[model samples]
Target chain A: MKDDVTIINCQLINKAQALKDVSFEVKKGEIFGLIGPDGAGKTTLFRILTSLISADSGQATVDGLDVATDFRELRKHIGYMPGRFSLYQDLSVEENLQFFATIFNTTVEENYYLIQDIYKQIEPFKRRRAGKLSGGMKQKLALSCALIHKPVVLFLDEPTTGVDPVSRKEFWEMLKKLKTEGVTIVVSTPYMDEAQLCDRIALIQHGKILSVETPEKIIAGFPKKLYQAHSENNYLLLLEVRKNPEVKSAFMSGEYLHIVFNGEADETVPNLKEIGPSIEDCFVYLIEN
Target chain B: MIIKIDNLTKCFGDFTAVDHITFSVGKGEIFGFLGANGAGKTTAMRMFCGLSKPTSGEGRVAGYDIAKQPEMVKKNIGYMSQKFSLYEDLKVWENIRLFAGIYGLDGKQISRKTDITLKRIGLMNEKNTLVKELPLGWKQKLAFSVAIFHEPKIVFLDEPTGGVDPIARRQFWEMIYEAAEKGITVFVTTHYMDEAEYCNRVSIMVDGRIKVLDTPGRLKDRFHAKNMDEVFRQLAR
Candidate 1:
């Protein structure tokens, strides 16, 4: 399939270079993720792709339309849910959805099928003001508004950043369901665990694209023999593991400490068991090296 | 015990935000408070911090009655929320000094501790830099160090590591361990289940009540789950 979204050598500069020679492609109907921590320039790149802000150099296209030149027409074909809630605070939930629909030159009833699954959950509270809703409800309402126009592609920036785990899971399930409707979804998040849910993810950091691949391929590329160790005191173990010359890197992960040895292990720590590297482990290794 | 509460309830008109929850934390223990959205964790935490008056029940924090001695409770505890922990416009040292002064530290102590903290966090050169200019990871570390600067009896951290990079998040956990070692009880809430595993004991709240409280190992075994996330999904479902 031809690419639904494509970028070539994109660059953005503010006080510092926000995005550096970034280039990636999202296949048709695939969920693409920009995975990085805060200040890694994920937001700047998102803005450039959405045509909300112009890049300093390079080119981008969504649905075969140039982002810079064809932005007016392109805007109608893409839905953007910014990191911050952009819905009208004083407006009722129902009113916000209607307003967005009207802006796209469509009615809520015309696109009702697109948002029905999510809207129905918050439908009972449609009369409540947007600001008065709970965090989860507010997110749902924002998403509903973004989807009310039935765009070809969706842009969700950190949609689940501060959401609770249960709510985050539910939101991902909703995205998976949307994938079946042939809507190309591009999302960004600071959570490493969420990277696995995307069809492909671009690991970005320090205004640079570190890697772009499937989550499984990224984990497979982890360039070290990782080990998991448990101790009565993980903090002390972390310090001790770091002190060893054979240890490449060590940090506490969950109930145990994760360690990477420099060479062949020779009774470095008690009960050292080799373990598969997680996405977080890969991210740390990539950033360090 | 450093903290204790019984039948703590906070009701807003007809709705009960926190419904008769009871739990206790020993000195120097790392307590993980977990819950779903709108599950009443923040309401209960507010009662613990003495920021809100409970509608009913009894509680004591750091040897002061929460209902009758809110001032004392405030004095004996430290708080750091992910949403708002430090002043963005203030210089790094200025924020430290401001919080220190608010905690009743004298000028001499503030200056001495300010230098010590900046050096420890390796931000000595960035002392005069505004907090907003620092990276998110650095800001989080600075906020944590400042929260414990007063050496309060208990430190309450609400999602301290949210959105931080993996390396920095682990470094932040190391700081939590060091605080607990100094006999400062750590009361923290986080959405990350792996962080829940780092706690000495974790309590999962459901519908304004603590459904279970135990060590991570034991909780996993009891729930027959592989990890804390699985255990959480099972309980939450």
Candidate 2:
């Protein structure tokens, strides 16, 4: 299989010891996910791969070029959208896109076909200031600017964190289209639900990779049988369920209390029904015992 | 009822920010106000909390007329936002104490309640650290604890769990439920449809109007949708 991005034991020990022995590979035309919490070092890894920051140890390559040796050429083949909005807020949407294009020695018209699908969504607001755009509109504009260079590998970090549900759904759809166009899209999100959209995901926590598997396989590996109990008082139900020796762990999930039984024993709570674990459940299980 | 609103409406020039939306919040109930961006949910909430003046109609929050007695309403309710306002330079314990002082809590009361709060949230060790030194999850939880430290009748949270991971979000919801058990009304706004399930009742707004208001189960069944996300999509469309 052809790999568009590869990392080998990347380590960084900046302020808080960000990354440690992190490594992952993304195949060409695949949507790879780095899923984790806020301090999980996802951003640090993206920076190293994008040639913004050099790793303390290990090596990374983008599109078959060494990230350290071919740093200059590597910059042209990659586009990175940082965790926070990094565009010129004072400039209009079209101005931001044109600025990035000019810096890359290219023009928006030159790469019109590359970012046409994304650009057209926000084209109506082309004259509006970037800062005045809504959260979803700002994200779309940032994505359009990132693709203005027509790079091979696209890096998106927590693009939909504060966006509404409808916009989040639409953003994922756009990413799926980009994948079909042979762009190796690497995105990171704290929301496990978004992980399901990626072709493959790596669950990271505390600067360490917990598991690397497809969303289905990861959930399938949840060791114990899970059950959901709905009682009048969910908080009380959580306390009561945890006190049971037969229960391994119990946590409130939305309206229901999700529990993992110690073993298949009798003494089931009334109205207890078996359920499947979601990506978040699997992530919690992987992080803890 | 902890809150009572009748024909609440607000306008800016020729645009109506909130239409004649009438609703009441029961004491100790977890009420969810959900909507897409640019919807009137925020405006309605602002009216209830006495932050914005309504062009017409009236409401009483905590038995204080929102229009006539905005000061009393402000004193009786707690408000926390996604962009939490905390003194980043101050230590965690100092921030808590500062809020306590603002609410006119005696030193003894402040010490006792904060001790219990620290133990409850498992943040005893972090009390002496600067607020900026804490992680995002911990900081959010701390902000919530301070918001309710005054023990107001109703707590208004604006997208309280935005950008938080699932684990922290789950724990945050659990805390909200625990507060509800103590007869403290929780009024919150969020973009997350999943969080709406935990509310005793939810209201969705669109274009300055209340589109639907009901329990999560009933709303889903009525709209013939599997989840609140679908319900919202159907309404927003």
Candidate 3:
């Protein structure tokens, strides 16, 4: 597959390094996720790659165009939905979409097909002010506006951070449909569960990439034997498990405590059931190690 | 009960945001409030926190009437929102002191509590560090500690662990467990399904009403699901 986006040795420093030697490549028509917690420099990398800001050093290219010098042309072929709500609050949903289309030298009707699925959900409130819409409705409007020009690449920063479970599922479905249309997506999110939806993900922390691989590969790479220690009092169990000398890491995992042993198992802890590690476990382990 | 509500409803003109929701939370219980976006969770939560008036309802939070004694309700409860709970410009100790004062603690008590909180969170050395300079996890922990600094009968946390890391998130939960142990009722809302399991009981709201309310274990069995995520998906769908 052809590379749609490439970031090489990107570094941004402002008193402290926002991104340190970040490097990655996104293949055409693939969903690439930059997974990390807040303040992990996902936005910084997105800004540099989308040509919104220049990196202090290193190179980035989108769709064969240089992010620095060919930014003006690049802007036309890429859509960016920032992490924060940046749409004009006073503008109606229809007006917002129209405004974005006109600024891109296009019309809503020109590329209506691109945003038709998402736009239909919010079209009933087309005349309502963007500010009056609910969070989910506003998100739909923003996505439609971003796609109005039929951009080849879409950059969504934490699009589902606060969205509920069902809405998040629907949003990911929308992304899948967009991928079928060959729109390469570069998304960043703090949710580890969402990492599985991407073709590839880079686990970033403290402005550095920990591992870049498919979700399954990352989970497979989890080093220790993870267990779900079932107990009536998980909080107490957690504290007790952490006190054990053989325990590597222990934390609550739903109904049970997820504990990882260092080398050998401790028979004293009853119901020490083994389970596969999730991307979240891998992420915590990578960060600690 | 720390919180009791009956037929609580909030209407904005013709649109009903919270539709005759009725539920009660026991004292010292960790109650999870679950809902989809625009599902009336925030609206209902605001009424519980006394930040917004209910269009019509009968409710009591921390033994104070939500509608008739909103001030008393506010005074007896601690509230924190994920978006704007702390001041970025203030130092760690300054934020603690400021909140403690607002909660009606005296100067001496504020100073004493500030030191205790910083030490508990292992941020004693960073007392003068700006809140913004601290990591997001630490800031969240500090904000939570400050929210309950006055030892309010009940504490409301709105999506407190939104983007926190796994380790820090568990640590935050530990703090909540400790508070609940100290007999402070915890009312928390979160989108993370795994967190739902930690709650003693959870109410899943849909549209504008409480559709399902039960313990995670019972809810999973009733829904015939493996985890809270599946149960939530079923209710949300």
Candidate 4:
């Protein structure tokens, strides 16, 4: 498949240097993830690609149309779900969906097949006000609205930020299903674990791309020998592991403290055993050095 | 027990936000309350914290009946919301003073506690800086310090690490452990499945009902899953 989205040295500057010569490509029918923290340039890049904001320099094209001049035409071929909730809270679920469809010069019935999987989940609450819906329900409704137009490419910014664990899992399932139907998905998330869900992910920090590769490849690229350990005192264990001269990095992951040894191991922490790096472990290793 | 609830329920109009539920939390236990949005976790927590009266049933915190002695409950417990609850324009030290005074610390005691807290959270150098100037991680840590400055027996956190970076989240969990070690029971609500694993025990609520309550390991074993994320999906499904 051809590259549906192509970006070259996309740079944007505001009060601070928002993006620094960022460039990447999204192939057709692929799930591309932009993973980063709160202040990272993920949002700014999404804005540029969606044609909501212009870049200071460089170029970005979606479906062979320049994002700079062909934004109006580009809008027709791309759908965007912003980081924050962007639905009419006062409107009912059905009304909001209809409103989005009408603005796109289409009708809900016209793209019924496009949103069938997601829309069916919230169809029971069609008459309920969007404001009154739960966080998870609102997300499904927002996604359905984003899909109403059946755009070839979808840009989702932190689509699962404040949603619960169950809802987060369900939402990702919906994304995967959408991918099978041939939607080019570009999603940004701060959650590192979610990176593995995407076909390929870019580890971004401070408006810069640290690494962009498939989750497995990123993990395989983890340079140091990693270890996962736990003791009665995880915080103390972390402090102890850092004191070791051979240790490169030590981080807490839930109940276990993940460690990276530079050379021969010193036994400051109990139950320290060599292990493969998870996406989060790889991310911390990338940024800490 | 630091917290005890029996058959607690809260209803609004025709909607039952919290169904009849019973649970008890031991002193210094890190208890996690897990739920989908509008699953009645917030309503249940408010009733426990004495901020809202339960429609029916009984709740006791710090040996005080929440329904009858809300003032007593408030005095013995500290609460922190997702927003961190710090005045943005105020200086870092000033926020500590404000909370310390509200918790009824005397003038001399307030100053002593403020110094201790500023030093503990490693904000002694930036105590005079405006709260808004501090980073999200520091702001959250300071907010937690102020909540516990009064030395409350229990601290209730609602989504404490909403948008913090991964490293800050690790440091925050360490602070939580330090608090728990100090014999202060932590009752926290969060959407992060990994955070749930750090708790001593977690309760999953669905549609105003507590579907399951157990240690993370047990919950995972019961659901035949490898992690809290999978366990949550099984119960919530």
**Window of ten residues with lowest summed lDDT in model 3 chain B:** B162-171
iRMSD per prediction, in order: 1.3, 1.2, 1.6, 1.6
lDDT by residue (B92-123, candidate 1, tens digit) is 99999999999999999999989998898899
- Per-residue CA lDDT of candidate 1, range A205-264, in tens? 878888899999999999878999988877777777888999888888888888888888
lDDT, each prediction: 0.90, 0.88, 0.89, 0.88
The CA lDDT at A96 in model 4 is 99
Q: For model 1, what TM-score is found for chain B?
A: 0.99
Query: Which of 1 and 4 is the better model by TM-score?
Result: 1
Weakest 10 consecutive residues of candidate 2 chain A by summed lDDT: A262-271
Model 1 ranges off by over 4 Å: none
Q: After superposition, how far is residue A23 of candidate 4 from its true place, in Å?
A: 1.2
Who wins the TM-score comparison? 1
lDDT of 4 by residue, A170-287 (tens): 8999898889999999998767677789999987888889878999899899887888899887777887788888878777777788887778776656998888888877777777
Query: Candidate 2's error at B204, in angstroms?
Result: 0.9
- Number of the top lDDT candidate: 1
TM-scores of the models, in the order given: 0.98, 0.97, 0.97, 0.94
Q: Sort by TM-score, best first: what order? A: 1, 2, 3, 4
DockQ of the candidate models in sequence: 0.72, 0.71, 0.67, 0.63
Looking at model 3, give its docking quality level.
medium
The residue-by-residue lDDT of candidate 3 on B119-234, one tens digit each, is 99899999999998988899889999989999999999999998676778878898998898789999999998988988989999999999999999999999999888899999
lDDT of 2 by residue, A1-93 (tens): 879998998889898647989888899999999988777888888888998889988888899998888999999999989978999999999
